[model samples]
Target chain A: MAESMTFLDHFEIWLRAYLILSLFSFLYKDNRFYKLSEHVFAGLSAGYYVGLIWQTVIVQQLINPMFDEGEWVLIIPGMLGVLMFARLVPKWSWVSRVSLAFVIGNTAGIYLMNALHGLIFKQLYATMGSISNSNGFAGVLLALVVVVGVISTLVYFYFSKEHKGVVGVTAKVGIWFIMIAFGAHFGFTVMGRISLLIGRAEFLFYEWGGSLGQIF
Target chain B: MRNTLPVIIAFLAGIAMVISFFFNPERTVLGTFQENLLQWVTIVGGFTLVLGVFSIVRVNARAVSRRSDGWFYKLATVISVFAMAIPSIMPTSANSAFGKVFYSIFPISWAGAFGTGPDSIYDWLFNYVDSPMMETMFATLAFYIASAAYRAFRARSAEETLLLITACLVMLWRVPIGEALLRSIDVRIPDYINMFVMNGFNLSVQRGIIIGAALGMASMSLRILLGIERTYMGKG
Candidate 1:
């Protein structure tokens, strides 16, 4: 397996190792190497996104159907799409507003209904259902915690109600819940970072260091 | 005419969209209208992306021409953009020599993960270069977070102490080592505690925040529909 490896194969793995190390160098201090890598990444991302947008959207969705398939009715939307470029012309900038208005209105309208049904009502139903369906003592205990946690967390965000007496105590409980939740999120993030580190280590030892590892 | 017209259009479009969503899964007249409107938005969104690419080119070109502080990097950026984009613009047939070469160079397993065709130069650049750089950039955040945690996680008060303890337990519970350590002690700690705290309490709190944010979204949408929030319409 080692003898069959080509120069290009070795070069690729080593280069990847070098780049990974260069990126890790930022943890020590931001240097010229890190800056180069960062700029390269930014440029590549912009280019990649442009290519992606063109392939998935413009040529496939717009040009293919409109020009090739002869969808004449699509001319209205096609014209609207072209108007987005009006922003490039100083005198015709106002023409872009028509497109922007449509985009924003449609987005806001879709999200409004989605957030209501998908997030608010669905979550409310799930929370209520959990309490009734809870099986054992532990399950019952968890249901209670969930109920209290939700109520208190909501109370903490209540701005108009002056936090005093019952509200004050509930808000205090809410803060505790929030802190614990934040802690769990942080723990998960730490695990994610560790996993990335492990991946880099695996590459260095297994793929890049394969020949070296075999030698040792 | 410029300002008032857009606002009116926004209001009409917004109301039509909401009315359509109320129609649910089945095909109604309004639902059909909404679907068409959505398709139009998708097409328009593509143009905005091209606009984005132009903006990047314009900015970098100016920086290069004017000999800005990091003009060398900006030049590099511009060069890299064209380098990645040009090769990607060429369509490669699956059965071609280039396709076979790519298949041998990049295994199907890796290519599949990256969601690219065999001969896609875009896929090659993304897999070998872009993903590593982006991952390392974000990985740097982990180090910074660790340092910050060390400084801020001091158990100076009761609340702070509780936070510190919870953070430690939560972190420990995620790994096999933590469970092993507990097992070694001959003390059986129920896994339910971890699940109850994280999944139940933590999730409930998140739901609360989500519901609150949804309410805020609805309110803002209403304001925008009513023309009360004209900031999106741009400067006066």
Candidate 2:
């Protein structure tokens, strides 16, 4: 709690309280207050980012090099960057595809090998190592549970063949694993939201209210 | 020419990138080309943000000009955009014009009051306006999601019953209240159950999903490279 309150502190607290209540208004029903806050938030965020990007990126990275240091080689990509604006002009829009294709192709190419190594190989290796490290009957049981869950879950998502009989049974088992995972995710998400709610409530009840109390 | 040229460009770029990653030796021209392309892509990405801002302005401006439903909201949006931008363009000190304007209007200060610098207005709006709104919006989602889960989480079959039981156990194991409730019944629980059953099971299943998704991504990337996925080039 801030004891020696300035007018700015009170002003900020009031602004925050109004925004919080305005957003919560949507829980009851969508209204103009919420709409106003939502739009203002969106605009402020986009505008703030524009400012940040200009300072950190455009000035430091692009402009400083071209004008101050005279690295004219940067102009090729700079030209490519300008071509992105061609989308606004329908006739010249195809020029933008060169830029987009370069991005997509490069990103896809980079991630292909990266994902294969990171996700597939590493995960498989870890699972196998875990199974190997397990000891005793209980450890074996746990290992079995993991193996079955993974295999069945993979089978459940296999879209090529129609699920029936043995395949159907395996997929059915897979659904249980998937549902449980979903429920766990749901629980975690709820807790995360509740934690944020508590933080806001605490600020409203203690800090904001306490600051106001000091003035009176 | 428009369609084919871009596709060819994509194929060449993708192939060069992939080949450079595996086959290009250190200090080779191919490696240098790969590095330069990566930098160029990042610069181009920044330009895309400009395109994004332009689109937002165009759309909101139209909504305001047309006097469409909730046109005032759009007006507010347009106004805030410029309002936020103005402060950042000027020096952010209490002595600076932008800072002076905010400080005189608000005139409130305490420990670490932020309206003293070039970023003063932007910081004020972000902390006071955006932070509260964004947090509360996400917090509100908790109630709706819980409601949705309650309605949809029905045990309709044997598999579903297994799901329900596992879910309940995992959820219970995760929270203090759930642990306290279990402890009250004189049934002592070990961390092993949480470790082996909940975490182990969840990790294995998630790994399966990760592997599947990785395979899908690789295949999709291949498609994009080969021009099978032409949706990015539009005509979709």
Candidate 3:
């Protein structure tokens, strides 16, 4: 494989290795190389999106359909998109509100239905079903824990009332559950980060380093 | 008219979306209307990215021109944006008029250098430069997380103790070696932690949070639809 590798391939490997090492340089301390890599990354990522949206949204979706398929109505959205550039002109900045309002309103509409049907109702139904649907003693206990946990957690967040009675005790229980949940989340995140770290380490050792040995 | 017109447009657009959800697109015009609205939203959304890129360019270019601190780095950023973006937006096929002109000016071998293709400059940069940097950046977080854990995992109070214990068990249960060690002590220890802590407690708290967030979202959406939430429209 190394014998067959071309100059472009070798260059690519060297570039990737350089970038990875430069980024890892930040772990020890910030340096010129790390800052350079960081800025390049930011620029490249933004540029990638610009090209992507231009191709995918403007050309493919809007221009093609308008010209080829005679979907002239698409001009409305195209015009609306152009209106967004009005922000560049301070005098006409308010003109961009029409575009902003449409996007926000559309998002709000989607969220309203999705939240009501997709999340709140489904979660409530699943909580109720978990208790009645328990098959064994362990299952029942788990279900009970869930029920108690949900109620207490909700009670903890209910700050409209004072926490001086049974609500106080339930709120305390809620805090315990929340702490445990947060701990679990933290553990999960650490596990994920470790996995990513191992992946970079493996790539550095095997792919980059192994290539060097093969080439030599 | 500037304010009132935008508010009205928002109400109409929002109501249309809500109504379209209830109707089947296959049978009704509302479906077609909904699709068009979504397309419009997407196109408009794309322009927001263009706006963002412009902002980046403007800020960096200003810094470079002023020869401010880190001006060289800012110049690299500005140059990078154009280098990556210009090639990506160029016509890929030499058969096209623009592509013919572009290739005549540049190298013919640079045909189809649009970002999506396998051999494109965009793809090459993304694979070699962008991706490696992103992965390494993310991997760096592990070090910070470890340092944070060392500082934060102290068992100061009962709640803190519980948190620490839970975090330890969860971390232990997640790894293969830790799971094996737990099983050696008692197989049920891991099982109990998974069932009681993860599925039961975590699930419930997540559910509560979801419900709370959903309610808040619904309320906010209603406010927007009613034109009561005009903050999105910016101040006059």
Candidate 4:
């Protein structure tokens, strides 16, 4: 596979190898190589967004519809977008509020409905359904655990009343459930990070190292 | 006027979106209005990126001019930004007037196309430079996580002990070596861990948290719509 590579392919492999090494250098200690690669990464990522937004949002969504398709009403949003830059000017900074408010309000409206329907109701229905759907003895036990865990967790978060009597007991149980959940989450995150580490290691060892061996 | 007008605009925009959710798009203009509003928001949102790019350029340019400690790195960033952006914004087709001029002026035969397509400068930079760095950055976190686990994974209380046990079981279940070791003890142990600890306890707690969070989000959104959450509108 290394022998079959073209000049551009070789160059790409070598460049990627260099960047990966440069970034990994941070493990040893921060140096000029790492700093250079870090800055370059930031710039390229930001620039990538520039091209993406220009092509997708500005041209495709705004300009094309307004001019070619005769959807002139889009100018209102276009003007609103331009208003965002008013934040740069001191006296005229207040002018940007209209645009900010629109975006915020629109997002808030979407989130409110989504939260009520998508999250709260769905979760409640799933919790109730799990109980009925249990199969055997172990299934029933697990389903009971789920029911207890959820109720306790919610009781734990509820701070309206002081932690005494039944509320305190439920809250204590909630704390244990939360701790277990957090531990599981931590383990999951570690595995994910380790997988990413393995990926870079594989690329370095197989692609870059293999190429070097072929060359020598 | 500055304060009141924005609040009104927010209320109206929010109300329109909420109202649009109920009506069928096929039957009413509200559907069309909703679609337009979403598109408009996206277009408006894109400009924020422009603002971001401008800010990056301004700050880096100022630092470079002052010859700050890491000015050279800052300069590299600014150069990288332009190097990636300019070619991506250019026309890809060699037949086009701009592309003809650009290719002739630069004369890089290897670059078969332009814009954000394959074999372009932007794509090349993204593939080789940006992506590897991002992967390496994330990969580096594994080390920090190990150090953190060593410090924080102590079993001081019942809750902490439960956490440690759960974490240990999960970590064992995840890795191939650990799973094999567990299987050597009892083949069903790994499955039990998956069914009991993960599906039972983890799922339930997560659902409860989600419900709590959704309620919080709904309340916050209501506040924003009612013009009570003016904190988003920065102080004058």
Candidate 5:
């Protein structure tokens, strides 16, 4: 299967090997080689995105309206964007404030709705749904346990007074529940991290290493 | 007044995007607004990211000038950055031309290495290397899980003792051998306890954890959007 190679073929092969090997170097250490590759990776990605934006915003959105379609609606946000450039001016620094206000108000309004509908309503719905198929004493006990767990965990955040009565007992149990919960989560996270490492190891051992890498 | 405002804007826009998915589906304008805002924010983020490259250039330039132990790295970084960036910038590189030329050679070359052709290098890498690597990594979790159970399951106090008992029983119930052993213990106990009681309870607990994590992530994400936390912005 051996064949002669051209100059550009050798150049491409060397480049591919380099980029692959350098990326894998991070597994060994966050050394200079890895840093070099990381910087290249980051810069290339950033530059590409910027180019895409220039095409999308300038060419598609802005230019199409001003030149092609003769539409003016696109210029509203464009003017606001221009106001952002005023921060560099000596006296017109305040121009960006109005822009900032709109951004804040717009964001707050959206999230408040999400918090109410997505988080609160869905959770309550799911809680009820879990108990729907549950029957017999075990089902009842299980639902009771869930209700207690959710409520007590919420109560654990209450810090108005000395948790001396029922609140204290509930919070104590809540802490236990949370600790166990975290332990479970920690187990999963640990598994995820190690698996990612193994993936890098496999790349180094096999792919680039070729026939030799598969010996293991 | 400063970049801080934009940071806040970016943060809030992220929250808006998430929230829009929930209650604002009827508000088509709001969805469009969030999408537009994020695109603008992304453009701004691109500029900030350039500042990152500039900072790196400054730091590594100093390191190279001072003759650091691995100054060759800074040089390589600069070179590769330029190699990838300059091609996109100037657009006269043979690589780009090569892409254009070979673009028509393969039957389906657009998506990736595999899409290039059946006899492509990418197809071979995908089938023999990348896919296997991903699957192997995912599979490695089984062993790590077994190890974690062995090490973490220790009895010390009342809670610890209870945990140890549950953990061992659960572990035993999961494996086929464990199920066989449980079957020999008592047919009804294994069926009732292992299948119905333990399995059902564990599933519920996991579901609860997932829900809790999702909520926490959303709240944290919201806080970041509102500019309550500026951790993502870095030291600058």
Candidate 6:
């Protein structure tokens, strides 16, 4: 056992277990350690994203043009970025409006071109095919179930307020269909979450335990 | 006025966007419009970042002025944001640079490097750090569930007894023991008293729970959208 497992390996495993189990301790009651861990996690994540945006977008999109190839088109956005500083000043902050419009327009432009191809139109086209295209009998049933589930779910949100009478009854039934689907989905999610915890626990038990754990 | 105007603009922009998808307006025309809008989005988003950067500047400036502890962190953060943003377009690493500078970063295929550099740092963080943490956060529901079961699974009245019985069956069926104890773990209709009946019951029960959960989520989202729920905004 000692031969197979290094001391550092054991220490690291236990460290993860301690952090995870300590996080779980918040369930019993709020505590300082949980807060500390949560805060650390937040700060870490924020820094991480900013790093990514820097690497992926800012560097690729902005700085590369400035330094690397001297592509002046990139400088337009750069100038616009500088223009955004208008917000800092009292009278001239409205100068940022030009910048804001550029951002909105660009996003709308991209999404307008790309989003429908992947999401709505494409998805609808795929689902329009026969249910047999689904893998098995169960899969076909599941597809049908999903369609009905989605429709019913939508009905549950039919909040025009005036939607009552006969349609109201149908809407209520839709709500039930949606409710059942949601409940089943929740159970699945709960199982998934529990599975994650169990997986972590297994890591602690098997990985951290010793060479005996390695054998299995 | 600050928030309201943006919301209105977003709404109008969204409506045009919806039309653009189906219409497929002439490329030369739409492309120009789209290009113009893309530029606008980039600019506006950058300006928005100015608000963000200014806030960062304030804290750091205050810190530098007051000589506060950890002021250097604020300084580092500001400097890093700038460094990362500048030459952000530059080839800090091969993957980062898009144009010709990116093309010549190295002869070796980046795939060979596999797990290195800023991209890899992000990939690693997301996989190991973010995924596990998210899973861990999700896993925490087990404790709440257990406590709820303990208190809620009591059989005080007839209704309670019925509820307890169903919940117990559900709990059993959910675990490994239920299939083991019932005999013939495989599918069969041995008796209405036995396997088939229980399976049907369990399937329906699970299905119902799934639908309820989805509605719960939808209700919550709708509430937030309608301004009925504002906890996310921090203090209603």
Q: How would the docking of model 2 be graded?
A: medium
Give the candidate order by descending lDDT.
Answer: 3, 4, 1, 2, 5, 6
lDDT of 1 by residue, A1-216 (tens): 365567666666667777788888888898988788878888888888777876677657876688778976677777887898888777888888888888887777777888888888998998898899998998888888888888899999998999999999999999888887877777788888878777777777788778555444
Error of 5 at B206 (Å): 7.5
lDDT score for candidate 5 against the true structure: 0.54
What value does the lDDT take at residue B202 in candidate 3?
91
> How many clashes does each candidate structure show, in the order listed?
0, 4, 0, 0, 2, 46
TM-score of each candidate's B chain against the true B chain: 0.81, 0.76, 0.94, 0.89, 0.54, 0.40
Clash pairs, model 2 backbone: A7-B108, A8-B108, B92-B117, B92-B118
Per-residue accuracy of model 2 over A104-180 as CA lDDT, tens digit each? 88788877877787788998887787689889997887777788888888999997988998999999888877876
**Per-residue alpha-carbon lDDT of model 1 for B29-72, expressed as tens digits?**
77677778788888887778878877898899899999989898
Candidate 4: pairs in clash:
none
Please identify model 4 stretches exceeding 4 Å from their true place: B93-113
By TM-score, the best candidate is 3
Share of native interface contacts present in candidate 3: 0.78
Quote the lDDT for B104 in model 6: 79
List the candidates' TM-scores in order.
Answer: 0.88, 0.88, 0.96, 0.94, 0.57, 0.56
What is the lDDT, from 0 to 100, of the residue A43 in candidate 1? Answer: 86
lDDT of 5 by residue, B35-97 (tens): 776555543433333444555556667787898976777665555444433333322212445
Residues B1-236, candidate 4: write the lDDT tens digits.
98899899889889888898888976998888888888888888888888788789889989999999999999999998898888778765455565588778776564454578777787888888899989999999988888888887799988889888888889999989999999999999899989988998999899889999999999999999999989988989
Compared with the true structure, the alpha-carbon lDDT of candidate 3 equals 0.88
Report the lDDT tens digits of candidate 5 across residue range A4-49: 4555444443454565565555545667655665555544444343
**Using alpha carbons, what is the TM-score of model 2?**
0.88
A156, model 5: CA deviation in Å?
Answer: 2.8
Model 3: pairs clashing at backbone N, Cα or C within 3 Å: none
> If both were scored by lDDT, which would come out higher, candidate 3 or candidate 6?
3
Deviation in Å, model 1, residue A99 alpha carbon? 1.5
- In the predicted model 1, the residue pairs found to clash are none
